[model samples]
Target: MSENTADVTETATEGQQQPIELPADHPLVKTLAAQKESIKELKVRAARADELEDAQKTESEKTADRIAKAESEAASVPSKVADALRTHLVALHGIEAEDAELFLTANDPELLQKQVDRLVGQSGKRKKSNFVPREGNTSTAGASDERSFVRDFFSGN
Candidate 1:
């Protein structure tokens, strides 16, 4: 027997012994074939959609990485500027460099300058008292007869 004929005959005998026949032009068979073709097309489209989605996701991740890097760089800029201004403050003021942090309260350049100037002006005022004592007061109590209260007090007499 032909392979196709044997397959149909065997399947029919194993079942109800009734032949399964349908005209190719039957509405139900046409509809089933159309559905199968639609399923194949849908599977192809689904695979293409997955590929497109993966490409889009990859692009989005790269964009996100760039944005994160840019944000980090932007954040560090203010910190670097503040450190530079603090170093300037420390050099100009001749005070501890750590004290410069207090003056970093403002981000505005004009305001920072104003605060630095104010600190410098205030520190400059203190310089007057740092001058050396009079030469007469330089001697010790028992060494010189200068005998002034200021001299005695400075010499620890």
Candidate 2:
């Protein structure tokens, strides 16, 4: 079995490709080396294309980019102001922190302030209740005895 395995291994090695060697001055070898250098130059140029293009941008193009950034920040101003207002009311005016969402959507600041004032005013008042006081016997032993007595009477005990 070992001799057969050796023969199989020799056959496999004989079937594999051997590396081709060429002289340094050969035309094919020179052409391949030049192509490799060209590929490296192409990869570097591709990586730098976007940055080089930005550096060469015209004044108007740079201005347009700045304007776009400013517009995005301007669009967020109202919401940012609302958030600051919500935080101020909750921290300084005694509004429940969880209820700040209501103030965020109020169209009129005065109306929101009025609502907050009312809420804070009522916060100090006693909580009203519809609960009424009542009294009743709570013992269960007498009921249990009654039930047992009725059961024994029925069974003729």
Q: Identify the candidate with maximal lDDT.
A: 1
Candidate 2: stretches off by over 4 Å: 1-47, 102-157
After TM-score superposition, what is the CA distance of residue 27 in candidate 2 from its true location, in Å?
Answer: 30
Count residue pairs with overlapping backbones in model 2. Answer: 0
Model 1 C-alpha lDDT per residue in residues 47-155, reported as the tens digit of each score:
9998987677877787997999999999888667866776677687786555566655666556777778887787778676755658556545475455566667898
How well is each residue in 1-157 modelled by candidate 2, as lDDT tens digits?
4665576677678996544455688778899999999999999998799789999999999999999999999888766765566568878976665666654355455655676677676775756766666546455565777788887899997
Each model's RMSD to truth, in Å?
19.1, 16.0
Q: Please give the TM-score that candidate 1 achieves against the real structure.
A: 0.36
Off by over 4 Å in 1: 1-56, 97-111, 126-157
